[model samples]
Target: MGDHFFRKLWQGTAPLVLWASHFFFCYLYAASGCRRETWAVLLGATLLALAGAGWLAWKAWRGGGEASLGVLHMARLGGAILALAAIAWSAMPLLVFGRCG
Candidate 1:
């Protein structure tokens, strides 16, 4: 039961988890009044999340079965791309918000 649960969990959820975490942090930082230090923290966190997403994408691309065209593999790739886009969207505010309020 334990192994089966874990196997299903790891099938293709890395990007989703990372995206949620990134969203939470970005929201927290923004709601903090966008302090001077928020820029540093936000940039750092975004970069770190981007790196993680990139890693997951690489793994998804390489870990497929002998069969090159599979639904699960394509889904993982799509998820990774969506995650990257979400991270970029969240990072955009850093440039839009002129300064601390």
Candidate 2:
């Protein structure tokens, strides 16, 4: 059950963890230069994070679906939602601001 511990943890919140990392890098890049390329990078990052969230949702539903993991399945779903919200929040600046002044 030792290795299974990490597996369960990842299955539980990988999407949300990835979202946190993505948010950090996106914000770091934007704050560094706010260049046009930064938005492109951010777009790519957001897409990747969203895709990860989708994968988490699909994984949780692959077998008996939510019935399989019960509370864990619900937690994964919650993580997916949070990931999407974080992605959206991180992306907003691209629409609202320009390169650093």
Candidate 3:
């Protein structure tokens, strides 16, 4: 039971965690003085985060057919979707300004 709980919890939170990490990296990079490579690095991070969140959403969507787990699956899926949106939103400044302000 404990293992199952943990697994579900991870599935629900992994994408958010990835987003947080990406957000932290973005701020850290900006603080480090927007170097010439800042745009490229930020783009890479954004793409990676998108891929991770998308994958997590896909996994949640394809979750096991156990009826008892339906709610958990939905929760995971919702979290992944939220993470994807947040990750994209956070990258918007990069898209618009193309560099640190």
Best by lDDT: 3
The residue-by-residue lDDT of candidate 3 on 8-30, one tens digit each, is 78877888899899999988987
Task: Write one digit per residue (lDDT tens) for candidate 1, span 51-80.
Answer: 999888888888777744776677677788
Q: What is the lDDT of residue 95 in candidate 3?
A: 80
Ranking by TM-score: 3, 1, 2
Better of 2 and 3 by TM-score: 3
Off by over 4 Å in 1: 98-101
The local distance difference test score of each candidate is 0.82, 0.76, 0.86
Q: Write model 2 residue lDDT over 6-98, tens digit each, in one string.
A: 887887878888888888888787768756577677778878877877777677666344476577777777777777787778778867874
* Model 1 pairs in collision: none
10 residues in a row with least lDDT, candidate 1: 5-14
TM-score of 2: 0.80
Looking at model 3, the pairs that clash are none
Lowest summed lDDT window (length 10), candidate 2: 60-69
Report the candidate with higher lDDT, 2 versus 3. Answer: 3
Reference-based lDDT, residue 92, model 3? 93
